[model samples]
Target chain A: MNAVIYALFIVLPYVSLVVLIGGSTYRVLRWATTPKGGGGLYLGLYRLVNRAGQRSYLSAVGHILARMLAFHTIPKNSYGRDYGTWLSVFLFHWGVFLLIAFHLHLWMPWLRVGAEAMYVMGMATGTIALGAGLFLLARRVGLRRIYGLALNALDDYVAITWVVLIIALGLAMRALAPPGLFGEAVAWATGLSSLHPEPPPAFPLFYAHVLAVELFMIYLPFSKMAHPFTFPVNPVLYGKFEDVDEVRRRVEEELGW
Target chain B: MVSVRKVTYGRGGRDILEESPMYGEWRREFEGRGSVHVRIKEETDEGTLKAIGVTEMQRIDRGASPAERKRFFASRVAEMARENRAFRHHMDACVHCGLCIDKCPEYLGTRDPTNSPVGRADLVRRIYRRLNKASDGLLGRDVDDKDLARFLEEVDLDRIWTYYYQCTECRRCSVYCPMGIDQGEITRAVRQIFVEMGMIPEFNARTIRGVYETGNNMYIKKEAAQNVLDFVLDDMRQETGRDFKAAMDAERADALLLPSSTDFFSNIGTLKGEIAIMDELGLDWTLDSRALEVANFGLFEDEAHLKYIGDNYVNAALRRGVKMVVFGECGHGWRAFKNYVAPRLEAMGVQAISITQLTAWALRKGRLRVDKKVDAVVTYHDPCNLARAGDLIEEPRFVLRSVVKELRERVHNREKTLCCGAGGGLLTDELMPLRVWAGWPSVYDSLRTGAQYMVAPCSIDKAQFPAVIQYHKAPIKFKGVSDFVYAAMYGLDVDKIA
Candidate 1:
């Protein structure tokens, strides 16, 4: 029974993550390959990257890092009166970052002592983050403009459900489970290289938490979260200058301006 | 190449007056006469407009508005808004921050916030929003005739006209706008509104009428255009004398050169240099005497006029059988040809390239040579139309730096470059003071570089720069790229360099 539970917890989540990431990458590649006229896409991309490169490399890297840490790319002022929704977004993003760092400890050998302390901090932050995210979900449903702009069937529900489930299971495994069970299970799994030690039978909530997180990662890049990967390029492309008159004149004089 | 025969007219419908010297002179002779109609025909040999006899008399009601005038005028706005997403988006997205205050030439020059593009756009937006709300919700009860009248009165028609006309529809403000609100689109829309209100500027009105009457905006007869070319070439010979020729309607030419009519009448130095540069480069280029204009006033009006002006260029190109067509350095003209005309032509099955793009191509192809040593510390001015509307910011800098030596580029160059105060057809007697005021910011910005000379590859800037520099008492000389290139290549033996 314990062996079955452990397989379901770790193996299922790993499979789901691989499938989601691989599938989304394929789709993005396909979309990029679609043929278009006028070289707008290529030129746009070149202009954007080149402009960003024109700025000192240190400045570009610093900007990107600051945005990642603070979510500074999103404007702070909402057109509508919804302070709670904004706060919820802020809390949730910060919490997600902390939680991801805590999870990485399981894979990173050097972070064992620090990871334990971080896990406790992350759990505390994650609880508040989960609550804030729930508040956002409720606000989206209540607010007409937000509901209209933000809510689509697959996006709104699939994302919300995944986040809520992960939070609930994580909380259960951390607070309600027998003392030392969570850490012991992680240790046992890490030590047993080939044996694949079974999860403690009583820690079923831990299995559910792992599964939820894996599902979330799979869906992330395909949805609105993908903005992180794309939005930074806009300013760079828009900043470059291409003098059409000079280009037109050269073309006229040489090829036919 | 094209010829027009002068036919005279009298007060009576068919009575002949006297034979005139030229068709344009004949047309002028009959101006304010009872009525005169020009008969235009295309000459096969030269592929130019051949004139038949002119007829006169029978004055129709000069002030009569078109049938369904209100609906017609309303529909024009509706159509323009419907087609131009940029115009609609800019109008809708305005936050009224008044940040565009410094960016507007009129407002910066005059220190009047009301003249800024954002302020003008806000007026339009408020009116549009009010109309929309009233029509949709209150069943038109929310807005009454009295309220409409009051709104109209508060709009400051003269100030609006002055400021809107003052804008060259350059997109400098749009560059800094957080919402991507193009002031050009806003100004164009405002101009349309003025046309509806029967408040068109006199000079602009005349130019539009000229475009309608003659194919070109200046109303230059084919003979007169040819004569002007001859006059300029003779002047060039006296000045530089290297056998410079202004080829008109030459068959199978590599390029169709469209010099602004203003360049011919004024700024003859720039014109001479442009011709000389082309000659020095050994390029196969020709000018068209029949359609000797790059400035298209139709951009300020309805699509019909836009199409009409664009068709003239396309027709000229097709008739001459040129491989490519190049426009002169006029801001709105470059914008019209590149952003509006070229795309429209492609849609109409007449594909052509823009002058700037062609020039950049030539540089890339090594057909044109530039000595960077000759051009040092050169700073470029971004004509708003080309910078914002046409998305042309870098090619000029590249071309200039490639030719001139030790070019020190301005930091706020390209998209952030300031506009010369004389855009938007505002360089008239009435707007002279306003032009000086509006041009102050640009003067300050350019003067910071302490460069000896400023290079603007725009014909309007070339015309406006002297007055602006003179008004401000700034010690900076303005030169077009062609002038600089020509001057740099003056004594360099082409064979030895090659």
Candidate 2:
């Protein structure tokens, strides 16, 4: 049991961390080095900065952020049809947001709370994540309308299912299991953060959740979930608007204007 | 080489391309006539592309062996996908939410998944992914030549030709895409790759050849173009008792007007409107013999032709010493002029502006006077290139509303505009049925407004929309925006002219 806990809580976390960082960097660099027509990312930005007036660029940034974070670019007409999917996705994302906030209790002293209060918080966020994740999975698999969209790959299903399992295991450990495992779990989290692999608490559900999270981390960079990193780099939504005069000026300067 | 797959439907049956609701109605009268399918296939040794009059275009024999063609295809895709940040990002970023499926006219018209932006983009994206997997060593062993050849064989080249050519590169799908994946850009890139292999559509290739050989897409010689201008001006003299002399090859001019060669040949109403506007404004504008054309088919082809044709006009402008270049009402021509040509010419200290912009400016300054409002119910069709690609959306409307009584709006207008069927060199005679079907959305939208006249400020729309309206049996007269503007002008009263 101790050996299993050590592998899941300590060694596996570090392995996942290394792969997450290295794989993501490699993915970014692979795309960055590819030769493209027109000016590269920076030149596109430079043109945007030149073409859009000062006010328009700032507003354009605001518009890009709305689209990236809020899925603002989804067609307005599709709202009535796909609102449930949108809502489930939002709930899942917000649940992840709260989960990240909850995890900070491992390091920050002020972030900690009473055991019962933590239990309530965990139940609330966990339920949202689990429910939303299941809804998304069901819609992707069961809904014939969405099923016809053609771009749904196998990884989409795998990625969502993996995260949902992690959420389910977490809720089970926190709300249904005996309430004595919280302190030891935090200690293990702090010890791992401090680069010391502590023997995790003798709670099977806790280890199960942690193991699932570690696997998810390793899988993150390989899937479309890597969109969080690459989305900002996309030229379509974020690139400079075309202004003939501004581009001409830049071209002229290159021609010794 | 690409060949069409012929589909014969029973009378009152669904068209196999798209499960179109009207396909049943379209076939109601068809006892023997069947539509040719736009689906793509690979060229076999026994059957080749049955394209006619395309010998003038360049053709490349990529190599004798299948392995060689496979290597060429893979390496070219990798090179292009790697170098272009937009291409790389767009290729990687599609989440396949399917938001862009219904937004595409080709997909809506054909109901073929391959015609959708995401589906078309994936055809090219899969090649990029295959090359990425091989080079990145995702597989334990590097992808060998045999595997690459097998992969290449699986990739139907004729399908790539049919679908990619079928796309108009309108960029409408990019507007509603959650990730901003411009699949039109991918289509253009794929088309450019095919051009590298010396595979080009006969329509685009022949038009490009004409531009090089005769300085225009329609092969209008200098004398022929000059004579057309003379005849139009002479008609203008008889109608309005106004001597309209368009300066040609002038030593120096304040503005140089570049109308599409189509305007000189077929779109005489638009050409005459341009003459009236320029005459009324009384600007020091010249229509030079060297730079008489504004249409750039290179935009439909690859970058080399784009540069060649772009430089041709720049050289003409330099030779004539014009300070400003005015692009007459044309869609892709204005895109090439505003986005591509204008910037390069700006460095040479010449200003490139659209005729719509000039008209808007003239209207604002009260330089060009209107006698009376046009007594017609009109709705505007926003050309995709002008609205989505270029930012000339409001100028045309502002000019039109000043002359016309009521300017009705289509269901999808401005940046969200649907493409006219005959764009990106899909304007050939053979694609007439496909063009008419693809144009159903805009034509249907116009009919919903109950407008008598469909006004569009584009040469392509002028040439294409009339056919679409006639085929759809829609009760709308297709006219250029400037045609109404000319009718509402002081000299040519709206009630006096045809």
Candidate 3:
């Protein structure tokens, strides 16, 4: 029983890491080899203005990060504009993002904060993630009709359910004891990289959260969850609303204006 | 069973426009049409296909049953992914975020979920997921022969024909998508796959063949086109007493004007306006039979045809020894030229400019003068290609504003412009109802503005708006920007002359 528990907690993480890295690398390589217009598919972006090269890298990075962080595109869509899916999506995405950052503090000691500050931050982020995640799940299932949409595939249902489960389990751990599993979690999480893998605490909520997260990491490369990894980093412009004159001026300079 | 003209989209004769519960009505008719939309394979010219050097795939064996035909396509789907990288990336990237659903004009017009961008993408994405074994069967299963057979059942001729053609390939949804997954690209790739398997719509297939044989989609013979131009110049001389003239490839010309064949046959006013503007400015320009068609219909099908059609224009421009190739009124044709073909020209130390740009630039420089603003209140419609895709948002409006007394802006203008339902080769007699409904938003917006004239610098728009206005009983008249310029230049009241 102990060996089995050890396998789930320790052996499974490296296996998950290998699957995640291997799967993503395979997808990228598969994409790299394919021909787009008898040329490589990865040959940068579809340049609209002939001479308008890439904007400064810093600005593009900031612009891409802000657009992704704010979930600004949702509001532009009709359902986002009319039915308020934008706000719901914004809350859900950020809440989960902050919650993950908080979890990362255990793995990276440099990100650690004061115990009292960490307690307050942990609880706040957990409640937000759980609340928003549940709403997202409901929108996928029960509230779909209200949004004038139907769930697309079995993948849609499973994706939302998995996310909500992780958030709910994490929230439960935070609420039930608040400070019970920190040392054990830190020891186990930090030790995963070391030769001697440490054991996790015998707490159901903590075990469940770790289990859900590890399984999700393994599943990420195969599913649509792989989108965010490439999307934000990809060179293709997404909702960079420059004034028409500004775009025109930038292009004209290159066109011998 | 309601007549398409009388299908008012749920509004009283002069009431404010709102969406009527007409989507359900449309859904029945569209689905009922199904694979009947697939024209006979005779439309696909094998010789033209070879001339274009199209990447061939396994054609459907006619003796096999329909089920066997789909099975043949099942194997070829993977080959398509291998041949086109953009196809694979777009297929991989769609997250099925239902935000893009209503962004489609077809879905908004028809209210069919499957006709929506995400919905259309999801259909092919399901089979793609299983085919590539990208997703394991937590919900998505691994593909064995039995799984492949079961999965291929989901990808049918009717589903591919109806849903993919329903899109106008506007890129409206792509602009709004956070990840920029263009459903238009996916639709083209799917169309290419089916086209290889000896299936394509009559309208798209016939038009491509027309371009190859006659140097224009309309198949207007050179002699017939010359006679029409002469007759129009004669009419201009008689009416306004202007010495407007067009010649076939003048020696030492600085630029070549490739007029849309539609302008030669249908929108003669546009040709007259272009000739008048260039003549009044004393810009040296000539027309040639080799590059007569300004619009490239090849863009509608796939890249093979796009390059083939584009080569015809490039060769003509090179032969003329002109420094510039000026495109007259066309939508996606301008996009193909500006984005794809312009770079090639620029590399050769030649430039490609739209007539709108040329006129707008000349006007700004005070080199070309409009003698008078035509006595008309005009609303400008931005064709989809010229706006977001082509980066020509302001140039046409600048030209229109110079020629018309007042330029009224539509609610959705510039980057947010609505598509005239007939772009991306969805302009066919059989798809006329779909076109009318898809064009409702543009017509409704124009009507609300109470503009006397609706001006778009697109041949497709010039052709489409007439049908949209007549069906919706809209009072507004449709004309190209050039018509207004010509009217303004001659001090002719467009209402009387046009």
Candidate 4:
């Protein structure tokens, strides 16, 4: 393999993995240590599933999942144009999530996803993601052009524009890849994970897709893309986890109100 | 308060900042965010909380020269950006999605870009982002030195002070954040950092200090408080021909009333209703002088003070050995009690209930009789804190329906409520227009009900709605639910309220 190809595929993947893992770790730990002062008891992970609280921990989890993941928090005042914003947001996020989920077999070849099934699901998800990505880009730009609203010159443009590019590139690869191209890519993926140096597909689209994915991973920790990982810091609900009375009885008796 | 963003920042009010090229465009974008937006005060006033021995007040640049102040601000910003987790997470998490724009009353009222929740969060977020990028530069990442400097230049002591203070910490924007990032928590963290540097708004500082110094938020001494309570009791006696007695700081009682200081000074009608209900129920209840405040100003600043004020309740409950603690008609205060202090009280086997809850229970039990409907059409406004955080949406309405001739409902009620803008200690002379602008939606919504009287269980609403109603020249009268209850108990018109 050429040095450029080797750096992009082998060296780049390892480097991206290191930065992503390290940066995400730093973010999670940093958020966890931030001084939360509302007198929470710093309950253990058990508290998450602990059924003892006034509002069941599991119930709180369900509520928060419905809120964050399910996009249940429609802005109270998002009546007219916001419905469009909501639709674009909903389509783009869920499309990207499913696209990524379907791509999981590349990292786990033993799943044995048939090529026909892969082609069908990949085309569906990729088409959806690509369309939603273009729509989001247009909406972010169009709203600013027409309405002069939520126009972040830097963060918003960079974040959305990058997603659109990544999705567009992935769709191109998924639609037009030659036979055995994906097999080579899968061999490269498994080999890379197992520390063998099999070359990725020689196709330019395959190289472009992998490079973009790696760079995206590196950028993930730097940008607000880290939101999903850092969500524990901003948990959906402030529901109490412990049965306060029971804990209080067991706790060291402080004789103040 | 669906105010359009005006094109000019030449407003004559103190709400408009003096022309500065640095944030001039930002100012123009938010020109009409509220009726006016507040400029962060350049100097501290008489009411600024002093370093009163109990709290350690750090003066970063209080008595420093300009150069020293600059250095101090830089150091504090860097330290907080790295050490404060809440600020870091929020600054990193917000994607500047404009969903928060229409949601924030400050932004909607003023149309100021910085008044927007995302805008305000970004004002701090930009500086902190630069700070983070600078730190990231240590790892060999390319960062623009001039860009960081420019972003840092956009925020200074005054800019940070002005924009952040505009947020009432209402959490209205947080409700819609898909990420669940609570901007209220971010505001409190930033405010606490400023407060540590002896930079606090006089109104918030004074209120907090008053709670610390005296038992109540208004710092009315025991004699003055007692006189007001006595006068209220006497007024009730003459009107209703029923002798209602209330004790202050009773050694023991079945329940303790954590009344807002306004109950004694500004809204005695609420006091009268509370007294009559507790008496009618035939339960032993006492209003403790040491813990009469229902406004927890500590929530606007820091957790230490939140705990400090909350301890007054714990100590009051322990001292009285009360089986229940009945919180008064205060919005944020009840929220603080419910989310933070109530569970602690419940843990100790003492039931924590609101006055609205108690009155609703009493009325529901058919134990308290309403002789006649209040001679008016009434509308109810849900205080943001109580409805959103305190689980108190229907109780006040239940009590209102029990007494009013006709109850009209506003478009925005219950958890999806608008803020009084006067909340989060924003009820100051400086931000009067901002308050009015923030109060516009609710005031007008209440007016739309064609109700002669508009009532809310929140003390802040009772305090804010009157001024807002007067400003808009809306003929709607604003009162507390307790006031209507008092009038209904005696078959009196709303005008009978003194």
> What is the C-alpha DockQ of each candidate?
0.03, 0.32, 0.32, 0.25
Give the per-residue lDDT of model 2 (tens digit) for A1-257.
Answer: 46766666778889999988988887788766665465532211122121122224456677667766676556344212356667787788789879978878877755758877877887998898889999988876753353233566677688888989998998888765765576676777788888876678877788788888889888887777777666556655554455544644543343232
- Tens-place lDDT per residue, model 4, A1-257, is 99988998989999999999998887777777765433342110111111112256567667667766667666344322355566667788888888878777778878887789989988887777778778777766764543344547565788788888888888898788888877788889888888998988898887887788899888877677787775666542535443434433332132121
Best-to-worst DockQ order: 2, 3, 4, 1
Deviation from native of the Cα of residue A223 in model 2, angstroms: 2.1
Model 2 scores a C-alpha lDDT of 0.70
**Is 1 or 3 the stronger prediction by TM-score?**
3
Best of the two (1, 2) by lDDT: 2
State the TM-score for model 1: 0.58
Taking chain B only, the TM-score of every model is 0.75, 0.88, 0.88, 0.87
Worst 10 residues of 2 chain B by lDDT: B1-10
Q: What lDDT score goes with residue B102 in model 1?
A: 45
**CAPRI category for model 2:** acceptable
lDDT of each: 0.54, 0.70, 0.70, 0.70
| Candidate 2 deviant stretches above 4 angstroms | A38-56, A78-81, A112-122, A142-150, A242-257, B1-22, B25-36, B39-67, B134-142, B491-498
The DockQ-based CAPRI class assigned to model 4 is: acceptable
Is candidate 1 or 2 superior in DockQ? Answer: 2
